[model samples]
Target: MRTTHALVQLALALMSAPQERHWGYELSKTSGVRSGAMYPRLRQMLDEGWLVDGWETSEEAGGRPARRYYRLTEDGQRELGALLRRAESDSRFGGLDLRMA
Candidate 1:
């Protein structure tokens, strides 16, 4: 699914960051995905055991309340590694000229 791919990209971005918690809006910005598409995928990832979500009460606002944060689960880390390896082996990406200037 396209959404799944986007979620994977989002997860990779989060993993690259030094911070532990990634809020919804931050993840959306980092992944180049809109909130509409990203949130449902995030919920699915949480249901699938690929991600863990929690609230940060200290950061709560008036009516909005706490923001939910997401982090990759152990299974998710392993899955990401496998997916990256597969992608690397695929000729579609392997043949690309990724050399930097």
Candidate 2:
């Protein structure tokens, strides 16, 4: 479940972004995860009804539109909170840096 924890941490970090929309590449870079790993995790989150994704046309970059954004669902937020609490309670995180942001 280490990957799952990483994925959830990535999602939480993304949620901290000021922008409402996030591109896949941006997420991958910020999360320190390669596209291969990030994309599958994202797909899993979507499949689990924990995320919503949408595409948008962008003229600034080029004629080609960027497959655009992803945001956490209400369920995702709830799950994140639960995960944070669990991690805080668990001794595995060393009980030093388990506080959730």
Count the clashes in each prediction: 0, 0
Point to the candidate with the largest TM-score. Answer: 2
Model 2 per-residue lDDT at 90: 61
Worst 10 residues of 1 by lDDT: 92-101
Per-residue alpha-carbon lDDT of candidate 1 for residues 1-101, written as tens digits (9 for 90 to 100): 24255655565566665247788888888767788878887787778787788888764655676787888788766655565555555565554322211
Query: Which portions of model 2 miss their true places by more than 4 Å?
Result: 1-5, 58-62, 89-101
Alpha carbon RMSD to native, model 1: 4.6
Q: lDDT tens digits, residues 31-71, model 2?
A: 66778778888788788887789877676457776676888
- Write down the lDDT of every candidate, Cα atoms only: 0.66, 0.67
How well does candidate 2 score on lDDT at residue 93? 46
